[model samples]
Target: MNKVILIGRLTKDPELNFAAGSGTAVTRFSLAVTRPFKKDETDFINCIAFGKTGETIAQYLTKGRQLAVTGSIRTGSYDAKDGTKRYTTDVVVDSFEFIGSGNNGGAGRDQNSYNNGYGSSNTGSDYSNSSSNFGGMNFEEDMTPVDDGDMPF
Candidate 1:
Protein backbone atom coordinates (compact mmCIF):
# COMPACT_ATOMS: atom_id res chain seq x y z
CA MET A 1 0.00 0.00 0.00
CA ASN A 2 2.96 2.30 0.38
CA LYS A 3 4.16 1.78 -3.16
CA VAL A 4 5.31 4.81 -5.17
CA ILE A 5 6.39 5.11 -8.78
CA LEU A 6 8.33 8.11 -10.00
CA ILE A 7 9.82 9.31 -13.25
CA GLY A 8 12.31 12.12 -12.90
CA ARG A 9 15.85 13.33 -13.46
CA LEU A 10 18.53 12.97 -10.84
CA THR A 11 19.68 16.13 -9.20
CA LYS A 12 23.21 14.73 -9.17
CA ASP A 13 25.04 11.50 -9.69
CA PRO A 14 23.91 8.78 -7.31
CA GLU A 15 26.19 8.23 -4.33
CA LEU A 16 27.01 4.56 -4.30
CA ASN A 17 28.51 2.97 -1.23
CA PHE A 18 28.94 -0.40 0.29
CA ALA A 19 27.43 -1.24 3.62
CA ALA A 20 29.70 -2.55 6.34
CA GLY A 21 27.90 -5.79 6.74
CA SER A 22 27.91 -8.20 3.80
CA GLY A 23 29.27 -5.42 1.58
CA THR A 24 25.86 -4.84 0.09
CA ALA A 25 25.68 -2.03 -2.40
CA VAL A 26 23.58 1.02 -1.56
CA THR A 27 22.80 3.94 -3.84
CA ARG A 28 21.39 7.20 -2.61
CA PHE A 29 20.19 10.07 -4.77
CA SER A 30 17.66 12.84 -5.04
CA LEU A 31 15.17 13.14 -7.87
CA ALA A 32 13.52 16.28 -9.21
CA VAL A 33 9.95 15.33 -9.99
CA THR A 34 7.57 17.91 -11.37
CA ARG A 35 3.85 18.02 -10.97
CA PRO A 36 1.50 18.43 -13.93
CA PHE A 37 1.74 22.19 -14.12
CA LYS A 38 3.48 24.74 -16.29
CA LYS A 39 5.22 26.38 -13.35
CA ASP A 40 8.86 25.58 -12.59
CA GLU A 41 8.44 23.78 -9.26
CA THR A 42 9.49 20.25 -8.50
CA ASP A 43 9.29 17.87 -5.60
CA PHE A 44 12.79 16.68 -4.73
CA ILE A 45 12.48 13.20 -3.35
CA ASN A 46 15.09 11.25 -1.39
CA CYS A 47 15.63 7.79 -2.78
CA ILE A 48 17.68 4.73 -1.84
CA ALA A 49 18.15 1.47 -3.66
CA PHE A 50 19.89 -1.70 -2.58
CA GLY A 51 21.36 -4.86 -4.14
CA LYS A 52 21.42 -5.33 -7.91
CA THR A 53 19.29 -2.33 -8.66
CA GLY A 54 21.69 -0.13 -6.78
CA GLU A 55 24.67 -1.62 -8.55
CA THR A 56 23.17 -1.16 -11.99
CA ILE A 57 22.18 2.39 -11.29
CA ALA A 58 25.54 3.29 -9.86
CA GLN A 59 27.17 1.94 -12.97
CA TYR A 60 25.00 3.42 -15.70
CA LEU A 61 22.94 6.31 -14.29
CA THR A 62 24.41 9.78 -14.39
CA LYS A 63 23.49 13.16 -13.09
CA GLY A 64 20.52 14.65 -14.95
CA ARG A 65 19.56 11.36 -16.53
CA GLN A 66 15.85 10.58 -16.57
CA LEU A 67 14.71 7.48 -14.77
CA ALA A 68 11.65 5.60 -13.62
CA VAL A 69 11.80 4.25 -10.10
CA THR A 70 9.43 1.92 -8.27
CA GLY A 71 9.72 1.73 -4.54
CA SER A 72 7.97 1.59 -1.18
CA ILE A 73 7.54 4.53 1.12
CA ARG A 74 9.15 4.16 4.51
CA THR A 75 8.97 6.26 7.63
CA GLY A 76 11.06 6.28 10.76
CA SER A 77 11.49 8.21 13.97
CA TYR A 78 14.56 8.75 16.10
CA ASP A 79 15.76 10.84 19.03
CA ALA A 80 18.41 13.46 18.66
CA LYS A 81 21.22 14.08 21.12
CA ASP A 82 19.50 17.33 22.11
CA GLY A 83 16.55 15.41 23.51
CA THR A 84 14.45 16.10 20.45
CA LYS A 85 12.43 13.54 18.49
CA ARG A 86 12.96 13.57 14.74
CA TYR A 87 10.84 11.96 12.09
CA THR A 88 12.26 11.04 8.73
CA THR A 89 10.83 9.26 5.74
CA ASP A 90 11.99 8.25 2.26
CA VAL A 91 11.24 5.98 -0.65
CA VAL A 92 13.15 2.70 -0.80
CA VAL A 93 13.59 1.94 -4.46
CA ASP A 94 13.43 -1.68 -5.55
CA SER A 95 13.59 -1.31 -9.30
CA PHE A 96 14.30 1.37 -11.86
CA GLU A 97 14.76 2.05 -15.60
CA PHE A 98 16.80 4.39 -17.74
CA ILE A 99 14.27 6.72 -19.25
CA GLY A 100 15.04 9.54 -21.67
CA SER A 101 17.45 12.44 -21.93
CA GLY A 102 19.36 14.00 -19.09
CA ASN A 103 17.58 16.69 -17.12
CA ASN A 104 20.21 19.02 -18.54
CA GLY A 105 19.01 22.12 -20.32
CA GLY A 106 19.37 20.29 -23.61
CA ALA A 107 16.83 17.57 -23.08
CA GLY A 108 15.61 16.19 -26.39
CA ARG A 109 19.06 16.51 -27.85
CA ASP A 110 20.57 13.94 -25.51
CA GLN A 111 17.53 11.70 -25.64
CA ASN A 112 17.95 11.17 -29.34
CA SER A 113 21.70 10.98 -29.11
CA TYR A 114 21.95 8.58 -26.19
CA ASN A 115 19.11 6.47 -27.53
CA ASN A 116 20.33 6.24 -31.09
CA GLY A 117 24.08 6.77 -30.62
CA TYR A 118 23.82 9.84 -32.81
CA GLY A 119 23.33 13.40 -31.51
CA SER A 120 21.71 15.60 -34.12
CA SER A 121 21.19 18.74 -32.09
CA ASN A 122 23.67 21.57 -31.84
CA THR A 123 24.34 21.85 -28.13
CA GLY A 124 27.46 23.90 -27.82
CA SER A 125 27.61 23.06 -24.13
CA ASP A 126 28.65 19.82 -22.53
CA TYR A 127 26.99 18.37 -19.43
CA SER A 128 29.67 15.98 -18.24
CA ASN A 129 29.52 17.37 -14.71
CA SER A 130 26.66 19.81 -15.02
CA SER A 131 23.30 20.42 -16.69
CA SER A 132 23.31 24.17 -16.88
CA ASN A 133 22.23 24.97 -20.42
CA PHE A 134 18.94 23.26 -20.72
CA GLY A 135 18.70 25.81 -23.51
CA GLY A 136 16.83 28.58 -21.62
CA MET A 137 14.50 25.99 -20.16
CA ASN A 138 14.08 27.91 -17.00
CA PHE A 139 11.56 25.96 -14.99
CA GLU A 140 10.75 28.89 -12.71
CA GLU A 141 9.69 31.20 -15.51
CA ASP A 142 7.27 28.67 -16.90
CA MET A 143 5.01 28.83 -13.84
CA THR A 144 1.59 30.46 -14.04
CA PRO A 145 0.66 32.76 -11.23
CA VAL A 146 -2.22 31.76 -8.97
CA ASP A 147 -4.98 34.33 -8.50
CA ASP A 148 -5.31 35.49 -4.90
CA GLY A 149 -9.02 34.89 -4.98
CA ASP A 150 -8.53 31.23 -5.75
CA MET A 151 -7.19 30.47 -2.30
CA PRO A 152 -9.10 27.71 -0.49
CA PHE A 153 -10.63 28.84 2.77
Candidate 2:
Protein backbone atom coordinates (compact mmCIF):
# COMPACT_ATOMS: atom_id res chain seq x y z
CA MET A 1 0.00 0.00 0.00
CA ASN A 2 2.88 2.31 -0.75
CA LYS A 3 1.85 3.48 -4.14
CA VAL A 4 2.16 7.00 -5.47
CA ILE A 5 1.21 8.61 -8.75
CA LEU A 6 2.69 11.74 -10.27
CA ILE A 7 2.24 13.72 -13.46
CA GLY A 8 4.98 16.13 -14.30
CA ARG A 9 7.60 17.23 -16.81
CA LEU A 10 11.18 16.04 -16.81
CA THR A 11 13.44 18.89 -15.83
CA LYS A 12 16.05 17.26 -18.04
CA ASP A 13 16.64 14.04 -19.87
CA PRO A 14 16.89 11.05 -17.61
CA GLU A 15 20.48 10.10 -16.86
CA LEU A 16 20.72 6.46 -17.76
CA ASN A 17 23.22 4.35 -15.90
CA PHE A 18 23.90 0.82 -14.87
CA ALA A 19 24.33 -0.50 -11.40
CA ALA A 20 27.94 -1.14 -10.58
CA GLY A 21 27.17 -4.28 -8.67
CA SER A 22 24.21 -5.79 -10.49
CA GLY A 23 24.73 -4.17 -13.90
CA THR A 24 21.03 -3.43 -14.07
CA ALA A 25 19.89 -0.43 -16.02
CA VAL A 26 18.68 2.55 -14.05
CA THR A 27 17.57 6.06 -14.87
CA ARG A 28 17.85 9.03 -12.59
CA PHE A 29 15.79 12.09 -13.36
CA SER A 30 13.93 14.93 -11.75
CA LEU A 31 10.34 15.83 -12.39
CA ALA A 32 9.04 19.35 -12.02
CA VAL A 33 5.59 19.08 -10.48
CA THR A 34 3.45 21.93 -9.33
CA ARG A 35 0.69 22.10 -6.81
CA PRO A 36 -2.89 22.23 -7.96
CA PHE A 37 -3.61 25.57 -6.31
CA LYS A 38 -0.18 27.08 -5.89
CA LYS A 39 0.94 29.59 -8.52
CA ASP A 40 4.55 30.35 -7.81
CA GLU A 41 5.93 27.09 -6.55
CA THR A 42 6.98 23.69 -7.86
CA ASP A 43 8.48 20.58 -6.37
CA PHE A 44 11.35 18.86 -8.10
CA ILE A 45 10.96 15.17 -7.53
CA ASN A 46 13.95 12.88 -7.82
CA CYS A 47 13.03 9.57 -9.37
CA ILE A 48 14.75 6.31 -10.14
CA ALA A 49 13.41 3.70 -12.52
CA PHE A 50 14.98 0.39 -13.34
CA GLY A 51 15.24 -2.30 -16.04
CA LYS A 52 13.31 -2.06 -19.28
CA THR A 53 11.24 0.89 -18.10
CA GLY A 54 14.38 2.83 -17.46
CA GLU A 55 15.76 1.92 -20.85
CA THR A 56 12.54 2.93 -22.56
CA ILE A 57 12.51 6.24 -20.77
CA ALA A 58 16.12 6.85 -21.65
CA GLN A 59 15.42 6.13 -25.28
CA TYR A 60 12.23 8.14 -25.63
CA LEU A 61 11.98 10.81 -22.92
CA THR A 62 13.88 14.08 -22.91
CA LYS A 63 14.14 17.38 -21.18
CA GLY A 64 10.80 19.14 -20.68
CA ARG A 65 8.98 16.04 -21.78
CA GLN A 66 5.85 14.95 -19.94
CA LEU A 67 5.56 11.65 -18.10
CA ALA A 68 3.25 9.87 -15.72
CA VAL A 69 4.94 8.09 -12.85
CA THR A 70 3.28 5.28 -10.90
CA GLY A 71 5.42 4.07 -8.08
CA SER A 72 6.11 4.18 -4.36
CA ILE A 73 7.51 6.99 -2.23
CA ARG A 74 10.84 6.11 -0.63
CA THR A 75 12.86 8.18 1.83
CA GLY A 76 16.41 7.55 2.92
CA SER A 77 19.26 9.10 4.84
CA TYR A 78 22.97 9.48 4.18
CA ASP A 79 26.04 10.94 5.83
CA ALA A 80 27.29 14.22 4.44
CA LYS A 81 30.92 15.18 3.97
CA ASP A 82 30.56 17.65 6.84
CA GLY A 83 29.98 14.67 9.18
CA THR A 84 26.31 15.59 9.45
CA LYS A 85 23.58 13.09 8.70
CA ARG A 86 21.42 14.13 5.78
CA TYR A 87 18.01 12.82 4.87
CA THR A 88 16.59 12.54 1.38
CA THR A 89 13.30 11.54 -0.15
CA ASP A 90 12.98 9.86 -3.52
CA VAL A 91 10.47 7.98 -5.57
CA VAL A 92 11.47 4.51 -6.64
CA VAL A 93 9.47 4.36 -9.81
CA ASP A 94 7.89 1.05 -10.66
CA SER A 95 6.33 2.10 -13.93
CA PHE A 96 5.91 5.24 -15.98
CA GLU A 97 4.23 6.48 -19.14
CA PHE A 98 5.62 8.89 -21.64
CA ILE A 99 3.15 11.70 -21.79
CA GLY A 100 3.50 14.68 -24.15
CA SER A 101 6.72 15.98 -25.65
CA GLY A 102 7.82 19.50 -26.44
CA ASN A 103 8.96 20.98 -29.75
CA ASN A 104 12.43 19.66 -29.65
CA GLY A 105 12.86 16.63 -31.91
CA GLY A 106 10.25 13.98 -32.40
CA ALA A 107 7.31 13.10 -34.62
CA GLY A 108 4.99 13.46 -31.62
CA ARG A 109 6.09 16.93 -30.66
CA ASP A 110 2.77 18.69 -31.08
CA GLN A 111 0.73 20.86 -28.78
CA ASN A 112 -2.02 18.32 -28.43
CA SER A 113 0.47 15.52 -28.12
CA TYR A 114 1.35 16.69 -24.65
CA ASN A 115 2.75 14.00 -22.40
CA ASN A 116 0.67 12.94 -19.41
CA GLY A 117 2.61 14.89 -16.81
CA TYR A 118 1.40 18.09 -15.12
CA GLY A 119 3.13 21.42 -15.34
CA SER A 120 5.18 22.31 -12.28
CA SER A 121 6.61 25.60 -13.44
CA ASN A 122 7.28 28.21 -10.78
CA THR A 123 7.44 31.05 -13.28
CA GLY A 124 4.43 33.35 -13.19
CA SER A 125 4.41 33.89 -16.93
CA ASP A 126 2.41 30.98 -18.33
CA TYR A 127 2.08 27.24 -18.01
CA SER A 128 2.12 26.67 -21.74
CA ASN A 129 5.82 26.03 -21.56
CA SER A 130 5.38 22.30 -21.22
CA SER A 131 3.78 19.75 -23.51
CA SER A 132 0.48 19.79 -21.61
CA ASN A 133 -1.61 22.78 -20.65
CA PHE A 134 -1.57 22.83 -16.88
CA GLY A 135 -2.91 26.33 -17.15
CA GLY A 136 -6.31 24.88 -18.05
CA MET A 137 -6.28 25.72 -21.73
CA ASN A 138 -7.93 24.30 -24.80
CA PHE A 139 -6.26 23.25 -28.03
CA GLU A 140 -4.77 25.75 -30.43
CA GLU A 141 -3.12 25.75 -33.85
CA ASP A 142 0.34 24.31 -34.16
CA MET A 143 3.00 26.88 -33.43
CA THR A 144 5.51 25.21 -35.70
CA PRO A 145 5.90 27.16 -38.89
CA VAL A 146 4.87 25.81 -42.24
CA ASP A 147 4.77 27.44 -45.66
CA ASP A 148 1.88 29.76 -44.98
CA GLY A 149 1.74 33.34 -46.26
CA ASP A 150 -0.27 34.97 -43.48
CA MET A 151 2.41 37.34 -42.33
CA PRO A 152 1.08 40.89 -41.87
CA PHE A 153 3.84 43.36 -42.61
Residue-by-residue lDDT tens digits, candidate 1, 1-153: 676867677778899999997899888988877777533566889998887667666767777777666678988999999999999878887555454544343333332211111122223322232232222333235434333233221
Q: Write the per-residue lDDT of candidate 2 for residues 11-105, one digit (tens) a residue.
A: 87789999999999998999887666674567899998887667767876777776667678889899999999999888987655444444354
Per-candidate alpha-carbon RMSD to the true structure? 11.4, 11.2
TM-score of 2: 0.67
Q: How far is candidate 2 from the true structure (C-alpha RMSD, Å)?
A: 11.2
TM per prediction: 0.63, 0.67
Query: What does the lDDT come to for candidate 1?
Result: 0.61
Candidate 2: segments with Cα more than 4 A from true spot: 105-153
Clashes of 2: 7
Q: Where does candidate 1 clash, by residue pair?
A: 39-143, 40-139, 64-103, 105-134, 106-134
Q: Candidate 1 versus the native: TM-score? A: 0.63
